[model samples]
Target: MCTKFYDSEFSFLISTTEIGNSQIIYEEFWFYTEFVNIFFQNTTLQEKEKERKIENVIKERKEIVIKERKEEKERTERKEKEGNGKERTERREKENLVLYKFLLEQLMNQRQKRNTPNNPRKNKIKRNENFAQKENEGSSSEEESNQFETQFQELVDSLMDSNSITRCEKYAELNHNISHYYLPIIGDFFDDTLLAVKNSLKKGSVEEQVLAIRCLLLFSITLEDAADEIFNQFEPLLLKYSLEGQNKLKIASIEALGILSYFITNTGDLDSSQKILRHCISILKNNFIPQNGGHEIYIAKVLNMCSLLLSLQANDFIGIELSGNNESDGGIFFEYIVNIGKSFLEYPDLDVRISSGRLITLAFNLKDRLEREEVVDSDIDVDAIVEIFNKLMKEYSQKVSKKTKTKQRAEFKQYISSIEECIYPKDLITIKSNKIHLEEWPKIIQLNIIRNFLGSGFQKHIEKNFLFSQLFGYRIKVESHRQKHYNKKSQRKEQKKNKKYRQQNITKERKKKNNFENQFM
Candidate 1:
């Protein structure tokens, strides 16, 4: 009886309690079975099949949302671009309308003036009779003109509310007081440019200062008359700006000084021209690079302007009479090159690098080696070459004596040698050779590269290249020589035609006479 009871109790414990090793195994197995049943029953579909369907839904929703956001962003951008473009076009149209209305009013007033007589008729009745009618007539036109002006002003006010920059589009007609239509306006404009440039130095927006200085530069290029005051007044302002003005204004002053110096030797005002050149060269010694983000572009351009100014001055001084006073100014040439050399070596820009290199190659061939050698101590060196090369290549940089790179200095030596060794100077100095002298022609090839990099700023390149006489000289030589050839060919062709016509006339006369003789026989 005891044995039977013990066996039954052991079986009951195994069935009900589940202890030790058996408990773990049973707990795992039971938990797995429960998990499998719960997972399958709670899910409405098979696990793998349901997972794929859910995942597809989530991915499609996510993709749709992402695409919507992208499309929304693109729409906003498109609207913004279109809005800006429309605003600009409207502003330009408004400016043209205002300028047109102003000119029309001024002309109408002038016409009324030209018809007026110095002496009035001596009859009081006649005067009183027409006074009311004339007044009404004048008032009607004046009211109409005033209405147009008011509309223009309202448009301008609306535009001004949005944009702070001066909204000067192309002017249909200059303001009545501007005096631009008269070619002889320089005599007056010289004074106006002088004042505007002076005031710009004192107080003006950066753009205003630039425009004012540019106008002064324009005035300095005198074709109608040689005004001493143009250069004379221009110099003091340039010197002041060179010494104390901010970066942008100072650069404008430098460019104006250089442009003023361009070809001024033809006007017999070499002294003042030299003075402008000398002051402009002063910028190279103590240049202003704006402490903002655009340091490379600004300083590079300033240096470029300074270099071109130096070249212009040197061109003037070439074959010119040099005295002790002129010798004092000679040191700046070396400094000018050195400053540009530093920009080439140190500037982190592709355009500046390429520009400085091309300018260096151009200096390669100046006839004055002794002068270049003296400055080579300071201006030409390896620092510049590496600086320039760094802009060109990411992996490689030039390694050489910091002092001896004198890239331009060495180039000057090589150019002088090549020109000196050549048996024919004219052959060595044709447009073709100059085009490839440095493998970086500014126009034929460099412009294309620059255009690819900088779009509308190519106008600046054009302005920069135009400042060089060689460019203009090259164009003029080709045009004028081609014109001469054309004229000669046209003359020869005309002569041949005339000769043929003469022979035909003689044949016709002979035929007529032969007919007469045959009739008489």
Candidate 2:
């Protein structure tokens, strides 16, 4: 509290000092001018002038302190020699410490200087010196760490200068290297990269910023066993991105949070992680239908990423609800499912609206559970939802006129059914782009991802839908018989046509064989 108060008050104190000095300097400079004798000649008192000079000097000292503070903020290489003055200030640090790590070291150093320096006990001191020597060997390790960090930064900046595919591949190699030799140091790498990301973001290069983010994301792979530690400084970078990064960066930042929340498999407690996600969910929801059309794609895309993460997070949080009623349960896992569905089924952009089967199943299950919780079991029917889905599929069926471009129809259908194991209701298509038609949509290949995953009733529910239905299903026996019958008829017709063509060619080729035989006879 006191620190915050001091910081706040100090800002105003400096502001006042700066303004006062400016006025005094102006007044003094004018004292010897032509206007001095005009109207303000003897009005200026000597004591006031003297007071102004003193204020000016104090203000200059204050200004110097301000400049030094800015300089100090940049110099975190750590002090080999103590008590660096304004004259000895550096333009940049050889290595910027992880701010938390720096704080810990500072605390240790301050304790050593104030208390340990005075301790006496000559024999004990010698013994302690040997131990301290070994402990302080961290200086050498720290040196190597700093050097490696600098080289890595240079490598990254240079790699970023190359074309994107090369940059991505280079990043992949570096990431693999960290995984091999420097696993323990990966967390600090993420922290340092935050600075570069901030710089790129400020420069307004969205591509550079996102690429930097992906580089930072590579650290996630090494964090497999020690993923919890990844959370230490993640929120700050994510918050910075949310506040200042471009659209892609913001989405990437949210995805990072999702990675943290869900990646840990079984992180003991997830309540803290959940708080950060609420705002993200809100953002996803709000951006569902953007004012202009194409903007909706970005919204859906971000939501798609967000939903997968949320599902994983919620799964971790719910952790097998034992009670009969986990009404608001499955934690973020269930919420994630619905939000994902919201993106694919509810959002404006057709291309961004689908996910692979497993995710779709997860989302559909979430909607089912959420709906079932408030309704009577009879009234809440999966089949009805399926019917609605079929309707949506029909809506998505996209009827293209025969004149439509064959290539475009194929492309549109592929987009509609991009995710395998996706299922839709009896509709031929579910969504449409401005230039696309309905018949080109892929049939919703139902995968029953949730039921296949959960087993028991889920399987039954999904399988039952697939097995029955007159207007919507293809019966195996009937389809097979029809195919065989068509094959036989087509083969006979082809053979007949071949024989007739051969006979006509032979008739035209030579009547000479017959004429010669008749003459000889």
Candidate 3:
């Protein structure tokens, strides 16, 4: 207590030294000294109380520190256990993946070896079995098949159970299970699987619908022997979704159909493939117009599907052409395709334009290959086709040049030229004059010359200059108008600064006048 009192009074004494009156400062210092002396008498009891409080606080702090240590230890132990559990789980997952991969690899190898034509034992051993033995083996084989089917059904049921299966896991399972070897087995249970897929499509969530579509796509690809029946089942579903579903579903269905077209071709059903192709083309024709809402993505997807169909049917197309089969003649179809693709080249969307360019380029490649090869009679007239292609290229170039700047116009032309060169490698098409480059010239001189020629009645001057301008390269550099813009900007900034300075000076003069008036008052 005496120490605290002395400290406070000493601080007060130092503060009082700043007092202007020496008498007041002296009186304050003396009074505080006397008060401190009187207070020193109770210092012994206060010191004991302070010591007791310090001991009590130290004891409480020790207890708190111990409790915190215990909690920290428990937390560390819990974290360690969790970390170990996670590590163990991760290790097990890695092991399972490795095992699954090894099993899959072994299964694939065995299937390949059994199917290989070079396997000598494959043909020799199966012919010598007795009737009884064959009967017994067939019975066992049927039993195994039953067992396999049961297992597959259970797997599918489990995958479809929303309570137990996540959407991502279902997709992963679909991708993992659908392969060259197991595809046929999966197709054996096609009726139930297709029903499940359709159910998912109709009633499942978005993710389930996508997975179901993927499943159907894989089923189409792998169901070789049953392609006709399965495709008959699938075609309606795909058509419904492509026509009436939401945007994402429509895109998926279109993509799946594109993939399915290749498998359809593989079935050697050219008529069916052609029908599918025609169906796709008809859809594009109906929906590609401006009044129908030309969704660019859907349009691109349709074009892509058409390209896939054409690629698959290139040989068939050649045969049709060579045999002069007008009944199935796709000439009108090709004309429609070319027209659609040419129109799309002018689409505002870059992706739409690119897809259109690819479609046209692919069509040209098919036509050129068909014409150049000796496999066909080469009787078809491609001159009109080539002329149309040239017209398309001209329009495409004009659209591109309009969208690009002067510096990039030449570069853009080169890009277009490269695409053309790739499409027609043997005979390249070169632009004679890009009209965009011709239009952006400073034509003051030409205008004045025309004016003078007209004024002086030089009748042939206009014709000569027009011919020269078309035949020669002449351009004028236009002056930059940016300097005037910079001058105006600087003039505005100077005016603002001058206005600010004038306002500040006026404020200062008003203050000086107020101060002078206050002094007088």
Candidate 4:
């Protein structure tokens, strides 16, 4: 009975312990499962948060980039708009300057009329007016010129303003005065005036364009700085207008360019002077040809300018004539100019021919001056030049002889004399084969006889003939005996006239004696 009771108690103890152990195991398993679920949920929330932040950062960057691009685009557009505004302002300023030029011109014209006093009655009536009144009138005229000059300054200064005045005749007149007068005095305002003038050249009226160019030319002479600026800006314009503009415009542009060349030469810039010379030559070569729209008046105008340029005083201040070593085209420009002048002599237009003739004369004079300065070598083709010169002289000499009216003859004679001066005496001597004996002959005999005796020296004879032919045209040589016979004939005629006069005197005395004897009887 005791053993059975012990076994039951042990079984009951074992069963209770097992139940406690199983409960502990079940609770721990559930606790671990809950912890895992909580940890996974926290990880998922963190991942989602990280993804949202990344998306927000990316969107912010995109917004910043877009904002920068928009700002840059706006800045570019603003700059472009400002540029356009400035261009418009410049355009308006140029237009207003033109209007002011016209106004100044009218004032000048009115003052000129008042000063001239066209009515004789008014002048007579005014003559008895007070001397003080006359002085006052002169003073008033002076004041008007001063006033116009002042008005011109105002117009040029207006170029700097953003707002310009209304366009009118007064503006045009002022532009004219600025070019014609004010620019010569002050020569300032090149920058403003240059732009205005350029605008005028491009789109202004014919008168306006001419006035603008005239102003620039005056400005160039008044100031060296202005000259440099003028050449840089207006050189192209000069070529353009000369080729494309009307006759007046073309002529005006050529004059302006000629003035520019004078200024350029004064600076002693050989390269620049050469460029101008080349350009002028090219213009003559290209445009003066029949195939290239050659105009007689235009060609004549260009020839005149070329002559002026070739004869520029290379050293005006010092009075030192240009030498072979001189900085201005090395003194060789005269040759090129002479060649051009020679070409123009054969031009179809008579005006062109006359213009070329004048140019040739000036060129020859320049060459001689340089030679006198000993600037040129003696190796020059004096023969060829003399040949050309002789032909030119022959033509003019014939013209003089053929002319009937004194005025016409005088004109041709003047031309002939001018050309005769250009012939180098040395050239004639050289053509005479350096024959010193030829100088001993009488002036007229030398011309008529020595010229023929210069055989195989046709060019020399032509020059010799031309030199003496100014007084007499196309002289023919007389045979030695014939010349002597003519001299005897002239002597015989003089003797016969003297004999007749003596006989008449004797007969008158005899009649007087007879009258006295009859009175006595």
lDDT of 1 by residue, 1-521 (tens): 11112234223221333354676557755865676677677675677678999999999999999999999999999999999989987865665564455456555655655666666673455467557766877776666556555554443233222232442221111221122221222332334335434654456566655665655544443222333455565677676765564667766666566555544644555665556544534444455344455545545555455445444444443432232244444334454454555555445554455445545543433324435555333335545454444434332346534333454344334333333442211211233235423222223222233233234433332332222334334342222323454465467569979999999999999999999999989
Stretches off by above 4 angstroms in model 2 are 1-204, 225-230, 236-245, 313-348, 356-360, 363-381, 392-521
Clashes of 1: 6
- Per-residue lDDT value at 432 in model 4: 26
The superposed Cα distance between candidate 3 and the true structure at residue 330, in angstroms, equals: 4.6
Q: What is the lDDT of residue 346 in candidate 1?
A: 46
| TM-score for each predicted model, relative to the true structure | 0.40, 0.37, 0.46, 0.42
Q: Order of all candidates by lDDT, from best down to worst?
A: 4, 3, 1, 2
Total colliding residue pairs, candidate 2:
21
Worst 10 residues of 1 by lDDT: 168-177
> After TM-score superposition, what is the CA distance of residue 480 in candidate 1 from its true location, in Å?
23
Compose the digit string of candidate 2's lDDT tens values, residues 1-521: 11112234223211223553787546544653544465354456666788899999999999999999988865653443443543233311322233235335545655565565444685478558857985987686576656666656665564534355545444544544443232334443544455544554455356655655555544543333233555554567666675344567776666565555543433455653555555555565555555544455445444544444445442343443222224444434454444345345544334454442224444554444444554212222344434434444544334533433343344334433432333333333111221212221111222222222223433222222222122124332223323454465467569979999999889866676788788989
lDDT of each: 0.47, 0.46, 0.56, 0.56
Candidate 2 lDDT trough over 10 residues, lowest sum:
434-443
TM-score of 2: 0.37
lDDT of predicted model 3 = 0.56
Supply candidate 3's per-residue lDDT for 434.
27
| Native-to-model Cα distance after best TM-score fit, residue 332 in candidate 4, in Å | 7.2
